[model samples]
Target: MASIQDEIKQTRPFPSPSAEAVVALMRTADMVRRSVASVVEPAGITPQQYNVLRILRGAGEAGLPTLEIAERMIEETPGITRLLDRLESKGLVTRVRCDKDRRRVWCRITTQGLELLRQLDAPLQKADEAALQALGNHDLEQLIELLDKARDVYRRIS
Candidate 1:
């Protein structure tokens, strides 16, 4: 297997291990995202849309406020209104104004949306498993711990 430096065809060594690790993390993330996209593309929904659906599913029958959905997203997405609009147009989600709080809009996944997610559940699991198959169980756990620690560093500094 080619190392990250070789894969990127960088002739010179990275300035530091931190820089190299950052580049490797980014490249690996993008590769995994692309793999996930390939799986979801056939279902006619982008990965972002699928993310919203799953979030709504977790929210249950009461649903969640628009802002709450945005907060719960795995990545910060600009123009959430547009994303919601697309999902609404596809009839996968419903947006309703909160009766008590007129300013807030509550979003819920439809039965169709639930069914779509159900269909995707197995395939998504398979894709995730395949993406991490190179790592043994212990290595995967350690990687998760290290990644979480790395993210926490930013959180603490910020």
Candidate 2:
């Protein structure tokens, strides 16, 4: 079977994709996610679920609401509710209605939830280590710097 690079091959010179950066970022994110997801899913949680828990844990006792958690999230918001639901069912988190606003619901990472996250610390670290193992220290730092600059450029533009 012919590869995409081969399929796009031409005898004559052609304009290269300005979209290569976008493709690289996306593919890198996908690879990183797949590696992490395999480790996370076995513990009965998705990548996003782990993200929310981590954020809540970082926030400590003050905690955060569903919306706040959603806002801080790197992914979509609607998914947070579902992720919270699963975590709640697993006895990892707790949901409580606010006193000032009866209609509003708030989420707090329970002790159990924090412990579960603690349990994943080593494995997640390992996942990151394994993902970047191929790249040398200096190259990895350079790659991270480049990605951060890319985000900053987008922020300045829009």
Candidate 3:
């Protein structure tokens, strides 16, 4: 397998180690995301939809407000309204107005959505394992720690 530099066919060296690491991280992330998409696409849902379903499942019967769901998503999704619209049309989710606060809408996963998630549980596990297989258990743990630290630094800066 080619290194990220070789894969990208870059002739010049990166200006700094930080630049190279950033590019490599982004490329690796993109590849992993595409791999995940392949597993999800067959189920007739995008990865973002799968994420929403999983979040709703975690919320249980009480569900969660739409904005709360947006806040909990793995990535910041600006098109949440459109995403929810698609899920609602597919019968995967329902939007209900909060009783006490008529202005707030709660999003709940439908039976079909929960069933879909149950069906995906195994495949998603397999996909995640396969995606990270190159990294042994120790390496994976270390990578997680390093990534967490990087995120902490980002949070502090922001």
> Residue 85 deviation, candidate 1, in Å?
0.4
Summing lDDT over every window of 10 consecutive residues in candidate 1, give the lowest-scoring window: 4-13
Compared with the true structure, what per-residue lDDT tens digits does model 2 show for residues 53-144?
99999888877888889989877678777888888999988889899988777788999889889999999999999998999999999998
Over 4 Å off, model 1: 1-11
Best by lDDT: 3
Off by over 4 Å in 2: 1-17, 101-103, 156-158
TM values, all candidates: 0.91, 0.82, 0.91
lDDT of 1 by residue, 1-158 (tens): 65986757576778679999999999999989998998888999999999999999999998998888888888898768889999999999999999999999999999999999999999999999899899999999999999999988897886
Candidate 3: list runs displaced more than 4 Å. Answer: 1-11
Candidate 3: tens digits of C-alpha lDDT, residues 36-134 = 899998999999999999999999998998889999999999889899999999999999998999989999999999999999999999999999999
Q: Cα RMSDs of all predictions?
A: 5.7, 4.7, 5.8
Query: How big is the positional error of residue 51 in model 1, measured in Å on the Cα after superposition?
Result: 0.6
